[model samples]
Target: MSATATDTKTLLGIALASGGYACFALQDALVKWLVETYEVPQILFMRSLVIVLITGTLAAHFRHPSILTSKYRGTLVLRAALMLFAWLLFYNSAKVMGLAELTTLYFSAPIMVVFLSILFLKEKVGAGRWLACFGGFAGMVIAANPTHSPNLIPALMCIIAGFFWACSTILIRLVSKTETTLTQMWATSLLFGIACAVTFPWIWKTPDLMGWALMIGLGLIATIGQYLLYEGFRHAPASALAPVEYTGLVWAFIYGYLIWADIPASNVFVGAFIIVASSLVLVAWERRSIRLAEKAAPI
Candidate 1:
């Protein structure tokens, strides 16, 4: 393939990945609002239900093959399990944590992705990418000031959720090699819906019209976000796209301030500046590496 084509794909990946995170930020904001009035399982069940219904209906229109016949069924199941586990821990933790702090902790998943890609995908990560990931993490910490967390256990849960999420992300990249986006979406959402359904009845509360609307909206956002993210992995290496996850932190802060009226300290601005700078540096580094590789290739 031509270098121009390769660059275009990478750029598309970055754009999709960044948009996925933005959708997630919106989801987190919505979940934070809903969790105050509803149980986690109930909320997740509703969200998953909507995703499954949408994906299932679209399957025929999109000509998606049977999930049962997928060669990577095992990996898809594992990824769904990991994702369900992560969401449970994360939303439970959301009860006590601020959106800024919650997303800041979860951003650890991207850093984990950079290393996991090396180990699992056998992708060679450059030192510059490593430094940028860490640097972004540090900036997020500075911005979030999680020292103010009202409860330590919930904070820890958020971090653990990040680990599970990181594993799920790697599996997404792995399965993307063979799976259609709709297939993965249907499989994961079906499994997720079933798991949440098992516990949903115990905590079921009939939502008000508003509650129903919000949860449905959450599911719609999640569908778009998941589709974009899966498409992104299809086009770009996980390690190269990992640092772009930091951009979510910026969106989290924006949403936190807008909806919750959580004000940022001066440190927030400083940290955000660092985060942006580091992400830009990583983009530049990736382009340079791609160019050098193209030059070294024989005609």
Candidate 2:
């Protein structure tokens, strides 16, 4: 493909990624509201059920029903399991932490992804990327203000959730090489639904009309978010889009203020600025490296 086509595809990926993160922020706000009245498993069971139904329908329409028997099933299951663990940790923490704090802590995932790539994918890490990682963690520490945080355990859980999320993201990039988006969505949703079902009966609460609507809404938002993010990865390298992930923080702060009347502390702003700067530095460094390599290639 020509340079123009590649640039267009990358632009589309960034757009999709931004939209996906916005949907996720909305989903998180919805989850925060619902969790006040329902158990995490109950909420996730419904959310996963909707995703399964939607993805299942798409799979049928597309006539691509071979996901379960795919050669990459093991990796897919592992990805699903990591996401399940991540969500459980995230939503549980959400019940205690404000959205701004919750999101800032979880925004550590992109930084973690860079390091995970080095470890699992055997990707080379430059000095610049190393410095970016250091800067990102410093920002996390600054934003967290662990000494001052009242909900220390929940804050830690949110950070751990970010780590698990990063693992699943790496898996998604790996399997995207061979799997259709529908195939990935179907497999992940099926396994996620089954796992949520295991403890769902014990924690189940019959939903009122609003409760049902919100839970289903959560599912719909999640489906759109998942589809958008998956497609984004298809078009752009993860490095190209890492900075786009920060857009969720903007949405998180907006929703938090609008829905809950929550305002962030000064430290949160400082920390967020640092984190976003670090990620941007990493992206810029990656682009410079790519350009230099292209220039040096033999004719």
Candidate 3:
């Protein structure tokens, strides 16, 4: 591709990724609102139902029915469990924490994914990237302000949620090598749907009209957001798209302020800047490593 064409694709990827994150931020706001009146299981069950229907329908229409079949059933189940738990923690934390602060803290997922990649995938990590990981953690602590009694529990929840999310992300990358994206989506929805179904009887609540609207909106928005995320990676290199994910933080801040009147403190911005810079550095380092590897290969 020409340089101009490449730049255009990159811009499109960034836009798609930014739009996806904005959708996710909106979903988070909805989840926070729903959790105020409904149990987490209730919300998850309804939401996962929607995901299953949408993903299943898309898979049947665009691909073969067998695309829903997976050889990595064990991995898919594990990933689904991890994702379910991660969202549970996130939703619970969102109930009491400022959205911007919670999101900034949760944005630690990419940094955590780096460390997890080294541990599980046996990927090499440079010293600089390792340092960036620590810097990101330090930023997380600053943003979380765990010393404050009220913030401690929610901060810890968000941290653990970030770790789980990182693990799930790494699993997705590994599985995506062999599995279709639609298959991955189907598996997550199927497994999580079963998990939610098991708990639904105990926590089920009758939804009023607004509650029903939010529940359906949650599913549609989440599925579209996920599709946009996939489209982003399809259009551009992940390194080029990573920075776009930070747009979620911007959306979180905006949504939080408008919906809940939540104003993030000064430390939140400082910490978010540190975390974002460190993440971008890691992405740059990874991209350089890939280029070096390609050059080193003999034709």
Candidate 4:
């Protein structure tokens, strides 16, 4: 690609990624709104259906040949299942939590990813990394205390979401090791769509105009967010892009406070700061470890 084209692509990728995060924040707010409008299962069903529609349309238009018939079938199914649980719990948390509180707990996923890599992939992580993980969880517990103005139940829900999210990440890593990202995404969408379709009828309800708007918006924005995330990672290394994901927290806090009138208690901010600090520690630790490994390798 020409230099101009490369620069254009880079700028476009950043815009897409940032837009994705904004959409994700908006989707969470909409889900919070829908907690009163419709059941979580209903929302999940509609959300998955929307992704399926959008992705399926893209598949047809692009004539992408390989999908679930790829090498990562097991990983795809597991990831889809885990992420479904994560989203369900996340929506429930949003119902009872401030965006920031939920976000703090959600941040635990990267730390969890570190430990999981050590165990499953046998990636060698060190003591500092372990300490970073402990610190992240500590922040979560501190944030959940009664003194915190943010409700405890939602924080707990967020913790649950974090666990599942981590599991989903592990599954993604396993799949990515063996299959194309696009194919993995396709398989995941298929499995999630099936899972949601199965549970949809139990919690299903016909939405009114506001509910319809919320669900559709939730679906569309979520799809865009997922796409942007993939595109961003495709263009830049995670070491660089990882920090940018933190911006989502800022967006979440902004939307929660300004749009939803969510005034976080003092404890929420304290806990969030700790969590953010821990994440930075983990990032630094990971980068250093990668550098050491690179130095040890033969050039």
Candidate 5:
């Protein structure tokens, strides 16, 4: 592709990524609202039901009947389980914490992914990236500011959720080498749906009209967000999309302020900036490493 064409595609990818993250922020807000009245299991059950129906319909229409099947069934189940646990913690945290603070802390997933790659994949990490990783952790601490926030447990939950999320990301990368995107989506929905079902009878509460609307809207929004995210990767490399995902912080702030009148502490902004800078630096380093490796490869 020409340089101009590449630029256009990159821009499209950024737009799609931004839109996807925006949807995610909205979904988080909805979950936060719903959790005030409904059980997490009920919310997850309803949302996963929508995901299964939507993904199933798409797979059948595309005539990819095998999208529900995966060679890496074990890996897929593990990934889904990790994600389910992560969401459980994350949603609970969202109910108690400021959206921006929680999101900034969760954004550490990429940093955790880097460390996970070094440890599990045996990938080499440079000094600069190591510094960046430490810096990202420091930023999380600064954002959390345990002294100021009396309830530290929610922040801790977000941090743990981010770690599980990073693990899921690594698993997804490994599985994606052989499995289709649809397969991964189907597996996640199926496994999460089953999990929610197992717990539904104990926590089930009938929803009013607004509650039903929120539940259905949550499912639709999240599924559409995942589709847009998939489209983004198709248009550009992940390195290019990484920065765009940060726009989610902006969305979180806006929604938090408008809906809940939550104004983030100054330290939260400073810490978020540090974390974002560290992540961007890591992305640049990774891109350069890839380019250097390609140049050194023998034809």
Candidate 6:
């Protein structure tokens, strides 16, 4: 590639990652708001339908349906089912716990992922990472004190959602070598949408005009956000952009404060700091280990 083209790609990559953050932040905020005024089932179904439509249209226009390869069919299917359940947990948590609490609790998933990796993947984790995992649990305790509060249930739901998040991540990583990202995205979302559809009869509730708007807005923003995430990976390495995911916590805090009149406890803030710090440490360590391995490799 030409120097100018290379520079353009770099810029696009930065913008894509940043844009992904903005769009997802907005999507989460909107969902939090809409859940209060409408049924979770209605909102989720609409969001799923609209997101699938937008994604499907984009996939078609790109003329790269092959990107959705048929490999990893089983893993992709399982991941999709897990994701649908995760979203349901997410919506319930958002509705009850609002944003700040939910955000802090949900991020504790990384700690779980670390332990699960030890069990399932048999990955080598040093003492430092183990300490960091403990620190994350301490943070969670701070974020979710055992008070007879309405949000306690939601906080626990977020914790459960985190496990599913870890599972989905593991599935994706395990299958990534066998399938293309595009194929995975389409297949996962298709299955997820279908799963969401299966719940329609039980939880369906009539929605208002605002609910409709929020649903479409969520679908569009989330689709755009996910697309930007993919574009970022295309332009730059994952290591450079992975840290940016933490920014969602900031957005969650802001949304909670501005939109929902929800203020986090002192413990929540402190715990969130610990949780995010541990995650960054883990990611940085993993990257260093990878580079060291590459350097030690034979030509």
TM-score of candidate 4 relative to the true fold: 0.70
Error of 2 at 133 (Å): 5.5
Q: Estimate each model's TM-score.
A: 0.93, 0.82, 0.75, 0.70, 0.75, 0.70
Per-residue C-alpha lDDT of model 1 across residues 1-299, encoded as one tens digit per residue:
76656766876888899899899889988988898899888888888888888888888688888889989999999999999989999999877787568868888888999889999999888887887888888888888776664578988999989999899888988999888888899889889888877875578889999999999999999999988988998888888788888888788789988988887889899989999888888778767867876787777
Candidate 2 lDDT over 1-299, as tens digits, reads 64445646666776787789899989988988999999998888898889989988888898984877778889998999999999999998877886557766887888788777767766566776666666766776676565445488998999999999999987887888788887898788888888888896688889999999999999999999999999888876565555567656657767888998978788868877886787677657656655665566565
- Which digits, one per residue and each the tens of the lDDT, describe model 6 over residues 112-197? 66666667656566765666566656656666564544466777788888889777755655665455455566666677667667
Looking at model 4, which ten-residue stretch has the lowest summed lDDT? Answer: 236-245
In model 6, what lDDT does residue 97 have?
Answer: 74
lDDT of 3 by residue, 1-299 (tens): 54445546655765777688889888888888898899998888888889889888877888744633667778888889999999989888878886546766787786667767767767565665676566666665666564434488998999899989888866765676566667677778778778877876788889999999999999988888877876665555444444455556657767889998988788868777876676566556545555665566567
Worst 10 residues of 3 by lDDT: 236-245
lDDT of each: 0.86, 0.80, 0.73, 0.66, 0.74, 0.65
TM-score of structure candidate 6: 0.70
Best by TM-score: 1
Better of 1 and 6 by lDDT: 1
* lDDT ranking from best candidate downward: 1, 2, 5, 3, 4, 6
Residue 192: error of model 2 in Å? 1.3
Error of 6 at 103 (Å): 6.1
Which one wins by TM-score: 5 or 6? 5
Candidate 5 whole-model C-alpha lDDT, 0 to 1? 0.74
> lDDT for model 4, on a 0 to 1 scale?
0.66
Looking at model 1, the pairs that clash are none
Candidates 1 and 3 compared: the better one by TM-score is: 1
